[model samples]
Target: MAKNQVAPIKGMTLPQLELMAAVLGAHLGRHLLDELELERVVYWSDSQIVIHWLSSEKQQNKFIKNRRKEINDLTGSKHWRYVPTHSNPADLQTRGISAKEFEDNTLWFHGPPWITQPQSWPVWKECDTTVLSAIENTETENCSETAKDKRMEPTSNVMDIVQIERFNSYQKLLRVTAYVIRFVDNLRKREDRNQGKLTAGELQRAANMWIRDIQHNIYSTELECLRSRTQHHLIRQLKLYIDPGNMLRCGGRINNAPIPTDAKFPLLLPGKHKFTHLLIQDTHQRNCHAGTGTVVTLLRQRVWIPAARQIVRSVLRKCVSCKKVSGKPYLAPAPPPLPKDRMLDSEPFSVTGVDFTGELHVKSANGRDKKVYICLFTCANTRAVHLEIVPDLTEESFLRAFRRFISRKSLPKIMMSDNATTFVSAAENIRRLSQSVAVTDTLCQAGTVWKFIPKRAPWYGGYWERLTGITKDCIKKVLGCTYM
Candidate 1:
């Protein structure tokens, strides 16, 4: 937005007038003018005014709405949505990324940029304290349409005040003389209208000398007092004479000249009190020393102390109140036990196992579906074991595999595995060992216990996976194929 605009096209500058004239003049069949002639020609185009003057103050901006789609996530399924331009800080944060993740040295994106960024700089910080302060102070933010032009005015003013220019050899007297001439001219016309006209050249010369002398005397005295002073005082005097109300107002600015007072205090601290060093500095010192004690009391009544902001910050930084109560620490639940090397030291006393889906009735890597491999194991006290590559995991095939694996070896005493589907389906029947075909004495013979790891706690099955890897590698070494 445009913050301020004067009425009538004539009030605008050549560039501004040219912009309008180029765009709208084409509609009206007219030509644009130059800056040299702009001041002389007050082009009050009535038809142009009617055409460009907006009836409503604000209109819906569709460009911002179209730009909203740029928020889709680049790396993941995650995406961002349009927060109100004023509400969200997502816009501020999109500044350049650094090698360090989440480093605060870069501006944190606090919200959509309501302000312009630094000149020629594209990024803005997003942190709350920085961005909010930037917004509040009108310092870091405020991408005014004027900043590009702002760089020009101050440079020009400095040049004007300090640059070489020819003047009468009378120097300072030139200005004083000019001012006196106007003042007397004003006075004489008033006198002539009220009384009678002066006829003599001698009388006019005498009057001029008297008036000029008095003016020169007063001006010379003021100049003597001020010429040795800083240019600030000189310029300030000039502005006061030009605009007194502005010179006194807080945060007042005119033609790049800031008032001594201000329209607003940009440095005003936002907290309850100035953040200070003495209040915040970290210290080992206690409030009261090794005392023959009088009551050690905090000043119950408010006390004011003048301190630099650094001091206040230091004090607050180390304040006992801030340390004890300013924030809370987070503590999470304890972790689970680490995996063991083996469940049992000796064979069959304890055990570990692996479980996986057996092959389905689909083509295998070897181009056969006739065989399905289901594998399981137990630690052994006596060398007892079972293994199978079966047709499938149907109860009949499983039982047959068990029967075949144990045809000659000693029966297993303990078994363990991750709780998987076929095993889970058979768990109850295996526990009871009651059905004729299911209740094999070789499996149930030694009071064998079938253990399943705790639900969803695969971490306990670490050894099982390790053994599976070993077994797969062993089989690969023995057979040409990587899988059985």
Candidate 2:
């Protein structure tokens, strides 16, 4: 038979905890938990607690009687309760806080279920909202826990039940509203108004989220705590991350906020708690309703939040300062169109574009040359080129070079050139003496297209432009002169 074995009753009182660290040869440190990160705390309005640890059943019973004597000796405050090891959450927290939180976030404390907590706490917990709807309508309590249930005669085994319920006047009005709407089934019509103030228990639901309590920071404390971690692979979660409501007052302006999306999770906080203007304003007003502070005081209690003119007014005014300074919303310009067809060089010189771009003083091979003009012809198909320089650009000089250029191949059906004064000039197009004055214009062939654009339209003639810029840079680098 196995004997029941409990761990030795070694209660490391605050001082003893420090001593144990030295015995184990580790440095012990003390630090207060941040307000937001604290959890599993209990508050008493008219009572106090005295703690003692007992190793055996005999000692446990003795400690109960000695508790009053100890309180009367050291601290006059006296209202005590014995909590079993299974229910003491502080056991888990003493091991983790601050730097340890990251490593231990997924950990949860096991509280031996308190029958009283589940029963009386339903006012806060089993708030499955369906009950709240019933509460709002003042209809037959949709919740199984009605006034009659609360008053049920208790057995001797029942524990002390703490009542934490607080109803709202406006909330009551909302219930009235809900009754009317549900009676007629007009939910969609008053959605905006209904969502705003009236709920079976609006703040009550929020209180469940742990945002509504601030007096002792009950819910905020729990949320700040690390009782839970997201199960996402990345421990991810989707949250607003910034409240459009408090917006810049806390984090910054709209421009600074990250856009909301479905995929985001494993959130850093404050961003997760953001609300829309209407929602946050309602929260702030709710905070104000607690009667402890002004709007600024109430807002400041949330520390990061800044004061606001009004949630609705601020959202409507559309402050550029707020948007630019913060993550604000705005429509962006659409992207430019993409090329539909893929194009490439088919052959070396089959498709050619010829253009003259110079007034250079290059020397001719003849000894007496004062300056030489380059008459260049480039093949669009092959991108191959032939160049000659002659100082003059007259028709006589042009035609002489042209004949030599045409000698290399059958006259091309399609040729491209720049829309320079010389290329498009009446003289160049007229052929000097034909009665039918032929114009030099772009023409398309089966394998190619010949075209010339007006000056400075480099983008339209990208092939030539790309090559020209390259050649121009080379010339400028070599000759110490800008491109012609």
Candidate 3:
């Protein structure tokens, strides 16, 4: 049997709700055992606080005492045991689930799997006394009349006047704070109220007011020690002193220098504060998005932020404009592993990459100019080159060049080339010729496989392409625009 109830709308603490749940479970269990004529029944609760309250002999308030008595009378302390919240099936009922989830859930129907095995049940451990004591203290205070009076007391702080973290820009915060101060002054004296644009003095006063509030909030103890003429280790080494306006300023050794007063004794600011971040951001923009070193130098001229360099670096790192202008491109991944043909150790030109270079003009014996092309065959492994000059790019012309190459070097088992029309046509012609009756049996048996790379990817056949470049360079140096 299972039962659940919604908590009262009047509001109740978590421990109070948990105790009420224990009472509900007790009522449900007692009715089930009475109606079914069961010999024994066990009760389980996820809240250790309720279990401790039921077992404890200590006196409790009327609210907890009454509920505890009802639960003990119905189920008895011996039947109560602790269960982990996650393993308790009632937890799902407290927090609703979708209809689909309710249909699929088995824990609600059968309880935790360990409920069938008595040895695996959760062992009872002592509840933390501190947690119980805190709950008791809270309950006691809530019942007292003085607590209600304390709650009615008004609390005020600087943040109640103006929230510093609400503004993104330091300049905007200063203007808004100045306006607030002006409005307050006008309320005090209706006549002769300052109106129109705010003067420079008002803005400066607002900035000082904000700075003083922030320092007092963060370093209240240190400020108190300084005011009482006592030493505090946190700011003792900085030689800090209060100015006439009651704002903390650094009293360094350079006070006697010819520089300005603000430069010699800059105002102290906490580096991790939100106002400090806004100040750094403002200075970064005013300097036309300068580097960290430049921003730090400019900021230190009037304000001394501890760990200024680190804070400036962090602030600059988040600037979108700087990121867009100075960010580096994504690095390319490493090159893939070399192909099997290129890694094989064999005779030079056994596996070759072939490509065509260019057309050259040479004088024939009849005093007529003829066009010639350079057919480059480079070793895939050794990078050896074998150049052959052909009259044209036709299959017959390239056949003769291929025959010359094989006759000079070892017969290439694999021929890799780009998918040029000349190479494709020559490969087709060689395939047809190899099956002809005129070809020798030895030549037919030792047939070479031609492999064409992907279309328009010259880098696939770079072995021969690079050799063609070198051959062109050599020709340029030797011929020097000569035809022959």
* TM-score, one value per model: 0.26, 0.31, 0.47
> Which scores greater on lDDT, model 2 or model 3?
3
Ranking by TM-score: 3, 2, 1
What C-alpha root-mean-square deviation, in Å, does candidate 2 show against the real structure?
Answer: 20.6
- 1-484 per-residue lDDT for model 2 (tens digits): 0112223387644323422222221111111123345432231110111222211122223334354334333322222233443344433544445766545544333244562473432121122212111111211222222333444222211111211232233334334434444444354566643434455464333322222222113223323221132122211121112121111111212322354321111112231222323333454456532222354343343333222434334543443443455545676567445222212445444455666655555444564435555666766555676775655776667666665675675345455666766555523443433233232332222222335666676555666666666665666678874233
Model 3 Cα lDDT, one tens digit per residue, 348-466: 88799998888888988897999898999999999988899998998889889998999999678889998878889988987787777777576666678899988877767776887
Kindly indicate the candidate among 1 and 2 with the higher lDDT.
2
lDDT of 3 at 224: 76
Supply the TM-score for candidate 3: 0.47
Worst 10 residues of 1 by lDDT: 241-250
Could you give candidate 1's per-residue lDDT for residues 1-484 as a string of tens digits? Answer: 0012233645654333423432332322222223233332111122221112211122213432222221111111121111232332322333334557555533243322533442432222122111111111231122232233333211112112222133222223233333444455678684544233433443433323332233233334433333233234432432211111111111223323343223222211112321112112212134422111211112111112223343344444544565576546776568665444243456442443535433424466777745456565534332233455666666566556555644544444555666767666555656666445555654445655667779888766765565555665665567644334
Tell me the alpha-carbon RMSD of every candidate: 29.8, 20.6, 23.2
